[model samples]
Target: MNKQMTRAFATGLLAAAIALLIYLYFSPTQDLSVEKMKQKLEKDDYVVVNATTYHQQVNELARLQKEISAMNKVKPTIKQKETKKQTTSKQKTNSYHLVISSGTTSAEIGQKLEEAGIIHSREQFDEYLKDHHYATKIQIGEYDIQQSFTFEEIAKVITKQK
Candidate 1:
């Protein structure tokens, strides 16, 4: 009777292992792709946050975001001061020469222009270049630009054929 019982238990274990293998082979797990994730984001109303951040303090993060919004509502506006030093600096930035390095990207050149105060925003300069398809046509050389020059004028000067 003991031998018979032992044989039955061994057969049962083998059958269970085979069943598990069949199930796994029939139903494979899936990985989420970028397109699928984008679709889910667009279709669903779920609020997503960093996994580790949410696990730590989701409530605190929400509160901080609210406080930031409140602060932005009361943000101070800039009022230009007409000091002598300010006037001198403004005059210096008016007519300046900028050197464009070889193989530099459009964003980098835009940033340089913004830093020199020849343009208001780097993003605006970049957009102007892209809209006019001059991003790839910028040449490496010295460019003389004034602070009052429009982005279009700057782009033209930078991309002109030598």
Candidate 2:
């Protein structure tokens, strides 16, 4: 009787597992169509900008890029005039925005940092990354780096290591 009961329990458990698998196999997946996506976005209160707005934004971005390029090319000549008493003023710190996507290498990141005046030499940065094993551990995302950060801090930030 015990042997028969054990056999029955095993059969029932196996049947239940098979039923679960069948049910899962035939279940409907989430709708991934464009219309459904639009609906979801609307439901989440996301605004979809019109073509005119998009075009205006693009133009503004182009203008900003041109201004940045012009600034980079021009070297300002400053005439220092010493006042009676120098006021202690806080200097503004510069920050660079970096976007790293899949397949982005350390060399590219280093070059961008160098161009942004965040890093002195791209080659040295690359070498540091390679030596520290951070080249392969870099996370793919956007990073805001202050000009005061050292190479170690930059590497830690890019690697999401805090």
Candidate 3:
């Protein structure tokens, strides 16, 4: 009777051990192995980095930010110049009115100006007017030119009616 009882106790113990092993094998409590995790990350096209390396990269970024902030405090001054170029151009483009008789070619106008002693030479005046493209723009009428007018000024005057 003692031998049979001993045998039954051993059988029960063996059955419990087998059940525990099977439960452990089918359990979801096991974490993925490090090598398996790495393979998975690689297959998913992800980069795996250690914690210390990631912290060092963050520290380097902070250092660069501090250096940039320090550099922004110093400002530079530059001098700007005011030029008379636009004013001169505006003066040249100004219009005026002139008094003249009919049938006035650019050469005739130059001759009139020379004869009146307004300009020195008819040839120079004609060339000046021609170079400035004032010939076609000339008008025949009484004119009021501004003091010290250029050929460009006269051309503007001649082209405009009022």
Question: Relative to the true structure, how large is the alpha-carbon lDDT of every model?
Answer: 0.81, 0.87, 0.69
For each candidate, what TM-score against the reference? 0.42, 0.44, 0.33
Candidate 2: worst-modelled 10 consecutive residues by lDDT: 82-91
Name the candidate, 1 or 3, with the larger TM-score value: 1
- Lowest-sum lDDT 10-residue window in model 3: 74-83
lDDT of 3 by residue, 104-124 (tens): 788886665556544567788
lDDT of 1 by residue, 1-162 (tens): 699999999999999999999999999689899778867986897655667878669778888999998877665332233455566777675876888889888999888878877777899789888988999999999988877677777888889843
Cα TM-score of candidate 3: 0.33
Off by over 4 Å in 2: 1-91
On lDDT, the stronger of 1 and 3 is 1
Cα deviation at 89, candidate 1, in Å, is 9.5
Error of 1 at 130 (Å): 0.8
lDDT of 1: 0.81
Count of clashing residue pairs in every prediction: 0, 0, 7
